[model samples]
Target: MVIGPRQDRRPTMNDVAARAQVGLRTVSRYVNGMTNINPEMAERIRSAIEELGYRRNLAAASIRPGQTSGVIGLVIGDLANPYWAALARSVESVAAETGLLLTIASSEEDGARHDWVVERLLQQQVDMIIDVAPRTVGRSWSHWSPPLPPVVFVDRPGDLAGADTVLADNRGGTRDAVAALLAGGARRIAFVGDDRALHTMDERYEGYLLAHAQHGVVVDPTLVFETSHSSGQAVDLVARLLREGRADALFAANNRAAVGALLAFRTVGTRLPIIGFDDFEAAPLFDPPLSVVAQDVEAMGRAAVRAGLDRLQGDDGPARVQVLPTTLQLRGSERP
Candidate 1:
């Protein structure tokens, strides 16, 4: 439909400007979420749009030749998991400040689903994507062609060449947590994790190994268990491990694994010494309290968005792999 004054059509930006007593450009800038609009002018535009019941043509704006969609796509591993949920919230906060909408999708921690998620995001033609999902097995980004949109990865880094990534000190944090367990006389520590395919899990496992090597404790290969990121699976694995009678303590590579381990404790009536990878709000409130190596997820989220925005602003420099630090929170659980 041609956009003009029409009695039988919905309200348009032109109608909004007329009602607000402002220039069309001013109304356009305000409606498009430009940050420079004067407060008084913004109020008038807001009131006029509300009163006129004006709805923006977001589809047209997204496809405009010389403008951005002002939207960012975010694909995380699993939205139900607290860790990814918290990270997405942080990304949303940052996106809001830039007047950009954040569209979040979950890959369900499956590689095939991850491929589909990225493809869907690309089809939406978002300005950029913040990838917090587990990368597909082998080389990631093979599903998408070159000249892709600006992409920023978090946690596990993306395999796309020259893609910016924000990573926590996974190896170091795991090593520290494991070493502390060792120092507390906890040997035969059962190492539990999600799919070994995840880069974050690989890093955490390496840290677990490093701690054992540093302490001169021989690592039993049989003690390591790889399972999906689920508490129920963890309960089964932990129960079996407990039945075998080899586990002295437990080191969970990620929050899901940690949750699984905790659930297993309840099932088997045995609370093995455990040090988890992520920190939750109720961790300290647990019966024995929880110990964990906490990643600065909020910072990682902020950095990922900042890098993507920079790339959008024509930053063509070599992709920077930013590594943020983690903190070891020692409650009573790590001691077993």
Candidate 2:
């Protein structure tokens, strides 16, 4: 009878040891890259490993002291969003430089899905996690407890006390955008933004208020609208505001909302001064190129990766909230 190892079974170190006619410890040392093996024995083990298609199990190897699976995980609100996509690419680039693999998942802005995706990443034994947390629905970070790897938050802060965070100066950016519109003689400025529950949006809204306060302009509450993270909804809301001549200028607090506002303005043929936060792919190609408060997404991504790596390296320092500056891009749309 010519029986052999199961075809479906992956070859293991034991199989390599048997095929090499060596002790299991010898095979272990060879696989783990330890030195001091006989040249002939090393040759036999190498040949056996190649012949059997044997691969080191990284998950198992990570259990040892000073070892890692060499994988990092990123959780973001939506990968389809250009801002998040850019951030992911930046993180991927940095990770590639260090020979670390990155695994990314989108939460779709659902709090439950966010928790589920995080749990799955944890199961994969990632060395660390970088997250751009989703807006929760009636839930706070204080309520949930899941064993987590070293985590660095990007774009938004999480409820975990002392968790490292990298973010843009949301308030300063929006304040500057509003100030620009006011400088261009825009009164009755309208503010459109994502969910009020989101910290990022809230900060932008605060900036809108602060700018008006500083400039001695009273903000009309009727001109501000907070909607779901939907461009279509933003279009509808903005279209109504424009048609009714309720707002002479608009400040869209996100890329998606800005797109919606653009479409609405085009349909109504209203060339109202507009400033958007988070520049998008087509922002510069509009009839009058869109002006924006551009966040340093690449820097945010790089900083998040560095923070996670620092935590992994046992920095154990005080948690940091690094806020990168945002720049106002005056691309003609802000001119009144």
In terms of TM-score, the best-performing candidate is: 2
Steric clash pairs (candidate 2): none
- Model 1 CA lDDT for position 131: 86
**Backbone clash count, each prediction separately:** 0, 0
Quote each prediction's TM-score: 0.85, 0.93
lDDT of 2 by residue, 76-188 (tens): 87888898899999999899988999999998988888888777787777888898778774255555465557888888888777689999999999999999999889879
Residue-level lDDT of model 1, residues 35-82, one tens digit each, is: 898889899889888877898987678666556777899989788889
Structural RMSD, model 1? 4.4
Sliding window of 10 residues with minimal summed lDDT for model 2: 137-146
| Candidate 1 residue-wise lDDT at 279 | 94
